[model samples]
Target: SQQGEEDPQALSIQEGENATMNCSYKTSINNLQWYRQNSGRGLVHLILIRSNEREKHSGRLRVTLDTSKKSSSLLITASRAADTASYFCATDFKETSGSRLTFGEGTQLTVNP
Candidate 1:
């Protein structure tokens, strides 16, 4: 099963500051991915960290995964008002049918100007 949940369901931050979100999962996973969704918009893939990797980064985003703990964390540096959105962590695992992806409840981020 690919079940996960994010902490601090909601977060408030100011422009130019850094925002961090944590996610924890229940079962083993093949890889984990982070996504960003603007209000009424489709999800944007941020980064993907494989089970063998510990951390990865792209632009202003950094993702770290801990397979032993079944957890992950995402950090956004120099946040902007435009960065305000809902961030979700999705876990990917292999099943009999095929690979499955399950997303967490998500963390609502509000970046102030």
Candidate 2:
């Protein structure tokens, strides 16, 4: 119902496998960002991709943004048990008032060793 809403709500995977989470937004965004949060911990910024960029990478994490579809995706390669956390997608909107950031519910990723 909000600007940024993620799909699959939850994910289960092996330690060596990969995990992917998708987010869809309603309005145009200046940029999109992904964040990770361990249980009972504060969120950590994962990556950020501007509207002009199609894809970006940081270590084992890859992010892709599609402006036409108003969607973005995050892929974690060689996921580990330590990577088990909640991943959220945030959209940055530059409005007449100012910039606004909206976060999705997030996808709970459980990595089994």
Candidate 3:
């Protein structure tokens, strides 16, 4: 099993501003993924980048991975107040069947209007 840690713990920004979050892991992984969670709700997958890939983008979301550094980052462009939520990074260990993800603590994002 692998573990992940998120930095800055929390973030605050105004609507239309961009938000960035980072994650670090302790072990080799098959892939890394990012997810968003509204308060008291289930997590929604945002993006995934494989160990062989460096970066990926989806709509207003961008994700970057550095397998060598065992770290990853997520960027949200033109963030909105509706973007206020918790962001998490997860790792899928190569040793496992990749059925589960080891999640980071999470970054609490607050977007003010």
Candidate 4:
């Protein structure tokens, strides 16, 4: 359980709003990465932060890490309908089980116009 398991399996937002999701894991990690996936578009890397880092932001997205509690959070600001997609958190450890990422059930986000 070194990977992340997100809560709130789904979320809906109106255009120009914001969305937030939380993730919790069970073991130490080297780094964590967030990814987004749209209907037709493939999974895109949104951001990544190492275990030593506390917070990271990119564009309208912000991520925070709390290693002591083994948890993380992702926030999207000014969300647009076009932002409708699924967001996933992944972890990379110094010792991986063959470089494979364990994914959770995922949180589906939809931004309505």
Q: Write the per-residue lDDT of candidate 3 for residues 6-103, one digit (tens) a residue.
A: 98799999999999999999888889999999998999999999999999999999999999999999999999999999999999866545467889
TM-score of 1: 0.96
Order the candidates by lDDT, highest first.
2, 1, 3, 4
Model 3, residue 56: distance off in Å is 0.3
- Which parts of model 3 are misplaced by more than 4 Å? 96-99
Q: Write candidate 2's Cα lDDT for 1-113 as tens digits.
A: 44699987999999999999999998888899999999999999999999999999999999999999999999999999999999999999777989978999999999999
Q: What digit string (tens of lDDT, one per residue) describes model 1 on residues 1-113?
A: 45779987999999999999999998888899999999999999889999999999999999999988899999999999999999999999678999978999899999999
For this target, which candidate reaches the highest lDDT against the unseen true structure?
A: 2
| Superposition-based RMSD of candidate 4 using all C-alpha atoms, in angstroms | 1.7
The model with the greater TM-score, 1 or 3, is 1
What is the Cα root-mean-square deviation between model 3 and the actual structure?
Answer: 1.5
User: What's the count of clashing pairs in each model shown?
Assistant: 0, 0, 0, 0
Q: Cα deviation in Å at residue 1, candidate 2? A: 5.1
RMSD of each: 1.0, 1.0, 1.5, 1.7
Looking at model 2, residue 30 earns an lDDT score of 87
Residue 32 CA error for candidate 4 (Å)?
0.7
Least accurate 10 contiguous residues by lDDT in model 2? 1-10
